[model samples]
Target: MTRKAAGNAPGHAAGNEAGEETGEEPGEEPGAAHWLFGDQLGPHFIDPARGGPRRDAPLLMIEARSVLRRRRFHRAKAHLILSAMRHRAAELGDRVRYVKADTYRQGLREAVGDARVTVHHPTSHAALAFVRSLPSVRVLSARGFLVTHDAFGRWADGRGTKHLRQEDFYRWVRQTHDLLMEGDQPAGGRWNLDHDNRQPPPRGATDLGVPAPYRPRESEIDDEVRADLDRWSRDGDVEFVGEDGPRGFPATRREALAALHRFIEHRLPTFGAYEDAVLTGDATMSHSLLSSSLNLGLLDPAECAERAEAAWRSGDVPLNSAEGFVRQITGWREYVWHVYWHFGTRYRESNTLGHHEPLPDWFTDLSPDGTDANCLSHVLRQVRDTGWTHHIPRLMILGSLALQRGWEPGAVTDWFHRSFVDGYDWVMVPNVVGMSQYADGGRMTTKPYTSGGAYINRMSDFCGPCRYKPTVRVGEDACPFTAGYWNLLHHHRDRFEHNPRMTQAVRGLDRLTDLEALLEQERDRRD
Candidate 1:
């Protein structure tokens, strides 16, 4: 007879150090452990040894699908979840049991027979209707931060408090952990040293750090990636940007870290200073290429923060590097989240200037022999060629184009998402609309970051062969950005012109009495 077990220490328990669960359910009886299959089986798999209603044994269940699409895509998420669950099950040994039902109704049918089954996968609404419809059953909201809505365990304490917005919530996190607050009590006493660090380059050639790419060395990952790529090959236009000359790259956590370590050591010091500047043959532009790692949750936030901060504390890196890195990890990243939740789903729909143009074809189509090439064409081509656009191009070129041309924020927002590998809702939203578009009523950033083509002309060699001249505004060959520069000012004059910081530029435009007329010519160029 298989013996059941009580609680084994699992890393899922908050205070428990991160590692594998140690399952040793003493006094657990056989046949006590029970597993319920939710609509979606979560990352953690259940143990079959000691699952039951006893103290040592507990119910385990899988969750349902968040949404259904008839076309099934191979879920890398599923593989990870299943692997974690199996690892947990091995750790917990006993009479632990689970369901193999395909549909929620079947799982529920089994759940009905076993009063010990606490977890469930209600595939159909009717399944849940039936289960909760019965007596001695109850439902409660989840306590995890991932909760979309509050049920019984809801906390209203956030209302009208420090949690009123994400900046406040992030500040709370900073203070709680003493990150960049003030004085010796703070972790470095400097909120930010970015201003000093963000320098333009002198006349010299720069070196490119070796890009960290990987082949799937882990046998399980390699085999599964091959299978999954084959399965997903027909989905959209999936490019296999991998080693061995495949364009696809690392799709797992282990390889992501290798990319990160190389950045921290080779690129982080110069990141903030030239993080925005773009140059020829400079694929990464002194930026730490760890955005995807942190976003995918492969790297824990606190741990990364501690590692970067610790490096600074040990005198391994300067304060500018440390604070600049912290701002990316702690300040801006957290702010992006708060802005999204505060703004809500419709935030993406904003069109501050009511522009209805499609994203410039330069975003999708490239021309080998055309002269009407967009001012942004060179930069958009950058992303298309390498799935990357450094900060300045994103903010100045793309953002400026959208704002000046009056494209719907949503249209440009979608463009931002599709063009980059790191484009997720949380990060991209604030970046696109707020920093990029200034569409969020100017909450995330104070000023619209726009400029004539000279800014790019000065920083990059791209201007030499660009279809339009940065200096010419009225001619057919003029950079549209230069002409649009004046039009944007005239268009938004009342709202922004009088502001002290912006008025200087507006006054400069006023001096060119024919500015409005030249601006009109610029609009014609877009056609």
Candidate 2:
């Protein structure tokens, strides 16, 4: 039997238990209905005035199977989200309704019964569209993000018709928030410490040990989730990848806080230096694995940034490390969210490059190791095993490879959405379709992030054991990335001729003696 939260309110019931139908009709009572999305589980939503649980409001949590069926989500990602929602409802104690339905719209209709409902604006575009379509529901602005919509709009208005750059926006956020700032200027006299970061992995660094993975202890909830997933797999009702093991992330607010503290003490110092480094065996290399919790609303982004800033002030960590950490939360995180809302739905469909190749089969499944390319295979293995790899690998390896090979932007975006534990529509679209793929025609990013194998060799250890040579651009032993790099330049040479950033690389392409033969060889290898 499916377990439900106990001790519900006197007038209400948990799950499908019988309760009074007094508020079943619309316009019957005030503050009678409130629904929460998976990402909006913070206590602030309960009582906005006092920031506590609302004892009188009827809370609803829905497990929508339609969302799961929309994409083949990682097994661990599904478990993490579902289990967290269940745990939140159980913790709320009373006046809570939890339902499992095929679609969110159906679930919301069932929960509301006949009462008028109020829903906070969702972080995702699809959810927002769904909530707006319901006649009985009223949508309110969401409360979790650090920057408000009005604030973001005002910032955008200041930019006028010109595209807003991340660096300028990042500085504005720092100055407005007074974080790591002295009066009107940055604390370190520099707005960015990015130059100090990006050091390659240190030799013999593997011997120093990596942070232990955050695997929560087994619970009844975990057992139930695992059973459900296994049943789905056996019955062929759902398709998911990755092993459904102990949830490798903190699910509750208290646990999230603990994880944050652990990261500050253990990983924050070296996070800046090795943030871009990619090693073969080590996945979590001095990087704060708090994005999942922050995105889920278990931890506030502002508070996390403030904590890192405080660490810098205390002299516990270097300015570069603290600044880098803070920049991610307050800068990139806020910027992307604003871009997603400002651009609206059409932003997702941007495909300026006009590339239309489907993603390779090896990306979806890595069983028996399909590819001979070590960098691709190792990174895919990390994702398949843990449902995550740091941003560097995402941008430099997986994303760059897709861009070089001219893969379909939507296909690449969908793969990212399904693969990561923290993947969401708002987060993936801007990062994948815009920044990583440059499919948005330099709207979100200044240029395409395409790179050769030399970059990979410089930043990572993946090239050392690879079968192909990183330096070769053609012939049988040529690294696919190197060959693909030249091919990509040749493909988009005319378009990027006027681009200042590509001028040097474009000029280098003229130096190729046998460009057509190299392109032909690359095509054959792909086929």
Output the number of the lDDT-best candidate. 2
lDDT of 1 at 29: 38
Q: Across residues 424-496, which tens digit of lDDT does each residue of candidate 1 receive?
A: 5556777888777767655556567888888877766567667788987766676877777778877788867
Question: Top model by TM-score, which number?
Answer: 2
Report the C-alpha lDDT of model 2 over 316-359, residue by residue, as the tens digit: 88999999998998799878887887777888888888989887
Error of 2 at 490 (Å): 0.8
Report clashes for each candidate as comma-separated counts.
37, 0
What overall lDDT, based on C-alpha atoms, would model 1 receive against the true structure?
A: 0.51
The positional error of residue 197 in candidate 1, measured at the CA in angstroms, is 2.7
